[model samples]
Target chain A: MLLTLGIIGILYVGILVLLALRARTDVKSSNSYLLGGSNLGAVIGFFTFAATLFSTFTLLGMPDFFRVHGIGAWIFLMISDAVMVFGLIWIGYELRKKARKTNYLGMSGFLELNYKSRFAGIVAFIGVFIFLLPYIAIQIRGVAIFLHATFPEALPMWAWAAAIVAVMIIYSEIGGLKAIMYSDVLQGILLLVAIWIVGYNCLHHFGGVTAMFEEVEKVNSALLSVPGPKGLFDFQFLLGSMIAIVLLPYTQPQVSTRIVILKDIKSLHKMAIGIGFFAILVILPTAFMGMYGAVLYPDASTSEFLNMTFISDQSNLIGAIVMIGLIAAAISTSDSQLFALGGELRSILKGDDEKMVFLARIGIAVFAISSLIFALLTSDELVLLARTSFAGTSLLAPMIFTGIFYKNAPNLTVIPMVTLVALIIFVASLLNFIPNHFLGIRMDLTLLAIMTLFALVCIYTDRSKRGGAIEN
Target chain B: MTNERIWTLCKIAVVILIILTFTPLVTPSGIHKPAFMGLPYTLWVGILEAFLLVGITWLATIVHSGRHEE
Candidate 1:
């Protein structure tokens, strides 16, 4: 299995490198490099968006989530994803309309440009860097831990992480966003194909889908209901999850950058619906694998269940495909995000285009190294860590939302205050300084509600004052 | 449809979908009493809801572009 996986990983990286080499000549300017020259069409746009949104979390974290929790896991992911797709249509249209009127390179630059406030971009960049770094590390660590478990004697966890980061940086530097998008197309296809094959095999192992669920129900009836066996999927938990996931494209730089790079509104619309379907297709299979785990390895730990189901049970070729797919998932997401961080830096830098691009690459290396260190240090729950990143960044949602939709800006003080408070609350929850769920409501949901209400009140007050002045 | 009208309707549709997802009206607790086609009823409803979302968004896009051409 290790030999097959190693050969496949090398071949996959080689294909990506060749693709990057072909795209290198296209990167004549920093704008072109960061934004893909704004030439992405429906096919590439849809796949890149899908690839970036669903990653190792889908392959590893999600099935484990389902096995440990229950069926509510489906609603937690699919519903949120469906809503996110619809959101892209409305948000994407407005964002693109705004982008066309300015030299929009990244979200931070857009915020700074539109609000006419340097601090706005600074706060935006800080919030993204803080929240997204761990999210990137989640991808890195997820794959590293899996590889370590698969080959206990092969190499250390950090070595696996460094290798993945090296691959991501080399390809990203060579081809820029263009190479990433093209590679995303390949990664997305491989992910969908590999997941379905494993899913079917798992289903066939038991009698069928019906028999599998029956077996799960017989073992633990909680697996079939809301707030499953562990009671992890309560109403409030699902609500908070929906909000975080729906706001993902707006808050996450990688997905949002893809939103702006599409060629036109028509492509964006097609891509949005296509992504919605892809979400359902990709997620349903994970549920199947989870059911397999629930009935067969009910008492096994997360890594144990994953290893048994995804690796030990499969033949050599299938195991290699799954491993490569996992690696592809990690790289597809990590590179998009790391590149977006570079784009964010480029957006804020005040220098010549060449110098700005050069600095941005350096910034990317810094971000990747930081993520590697975090991956080595922290290996928390994947889905929960990802949720924290989402909630933290969603605090900046109001800032960006107002920047795009409203003609008049609110008090600049509100942006940083909201961001600071949101991050503090999330970090506190992570450290157990505050409860994750307060009185049955998730803390992140409560935080988002408070932030949105604050933004609304400020907007209403400012608008009323302007209205009174106009009347007078 | 003008941009304002189209965007307002899109927002309304999205809000409705969200409410459906969160409310017990479409939840498995409400719907998953029986298994159908190898899935709990809640999953079936969720799938249907997703398709409805795709349908509405597609229609909105068409309306927006149709108005543009007009």
Candidate 2:
């Protein structure tokens, strides 16, 4: 245990210094700090994108999914990411270009520009805060989970989270995105290697792929189901996964930075495919490891499944290995998220209203604290939260989709329709007044349908104005 | 392409991308995501906002340069 911890500790201190030093150069202004001066190149872009994708989910929650279900759980995630490839190409590539032209630094800024309504910007700002806080909460939960399970007497998860949050804050303070991408590159590499080891071990344990699948079949037939145990096949899970894939990380400020980071359209294509392949390869193993856990541990609770089931021994070596990957995933994502959080800070709170690095740093701290609170407060495990977040975004789909399906939308109509969708979702979540599925359709699907109808009518009714509004 | 054509194409491409990202190929599941990582998905979507930006801004730069030449 000591030996493994020593190795991981040495790695942490050594590489972190190098990462810090890299960011030391050209560290100035929120622009360069937040977006890397629109100068992030191919290598950094790829890793940052990959790192951004890591999050705690990759390191921890995926194994939980596997232990709960089987090989099929992994297939769902891999397929979702695969499907996400197209969505990223379609959404990310062009949005990067438009944002550059408009000088839109944040999502709110883009909507403001497109809709020609400051209200859209305000709505965006509020929406961003709502989504980002919970995403951060999960990271905190992973940290807590790690400390809680690994150590007989761990530091309070809050203290550990605060310390972890503090380190991220310090670097983000000094380097902005430069710190993030550099660290991300390092974290990205660690995650990939660790994933390989874990995957190899799991496959070995399972006696190989053929035997593994057979065992999975032998186990609960539900593991073979499309959605896995929790009715993942229920209309809600399928459609929710679709909406979540596109809706979640795609909108983040750090993600937007990658758009500008691309050298050209050709590079954008490469980054997309590269990141997609990497995400698949990396997540593929982790998810499969989950299946291995399902085979090994069988019936285990979702939260404790990864460590309780996957890791047989709590000795330092295994702990160090998992910790390294977990930290890599956490730091890589949190750092990027920190930078993106800064971008939104300027957009919603500052936006030509103010520019204070100190203020942004303070905001970062607040964000971390809030995330810690939310994680501790919420009882939902990783997958439940993942599904819930997906539902939230699917609700917003039609409002934005109108730009694709039609060329016009009337604000008078759109404003109310978007309001209606959000209101309905808020009500649905709070009241559970209706079944998740309506008329043999998932409620989320129903919501999307309604969203589409409203968007279409708005566009159709407002189309003739000739560049009259936020539509194509 | 003329400067105007470039701007037009750039604008069109960007618009198409945004629509594509937010809209799904298949219908959605009723599951609602209250937040990701802790923020709304819209906040996360800001990352791609840069892509739309670069294309259109480049087009504008080109157009502005043409006007200067004119």
Worst 10 residues of 2 chain A by lDDT: A401-410
* Cα error, candidate 1, residue B68 (Å): 4.9
Residue A175 in model 1: lDDT: 89
Q: Which candidate is the best by TM-score?
A: 1
Q: Write the per-residue lDDT of candidate 2 for residues A72-103, one digit (tens) a residue.
A: 34434554554455445555655555556655
Q: What is the lDDT of residue A161 in candidate 1?
A: 92
The regions of model 1 sitting more than 4 angstroms off are A26-28, A410-413, A434-440, A468-472, B1-13, B28-31, B65-70
The TM-score that candidate 1 achieves is 0.94
The best candidate by DockQ is 1
Q: Write the residue-wise lDDT of candidate 1 on A206-226 in tens digits.
A: 868788877887888787777
Candidate 2 residue-wise lDDT, B1-70, digit = tens: 7766765665576556544443432112222123244222221232234334443443444443222320
Name the top lDDT candidate: 1
- Give TM-scores of chain A for all candidates: 0.96, 0.89
Ten contiguous residues with the weakest lDDT in model 1 chain A: A463-472
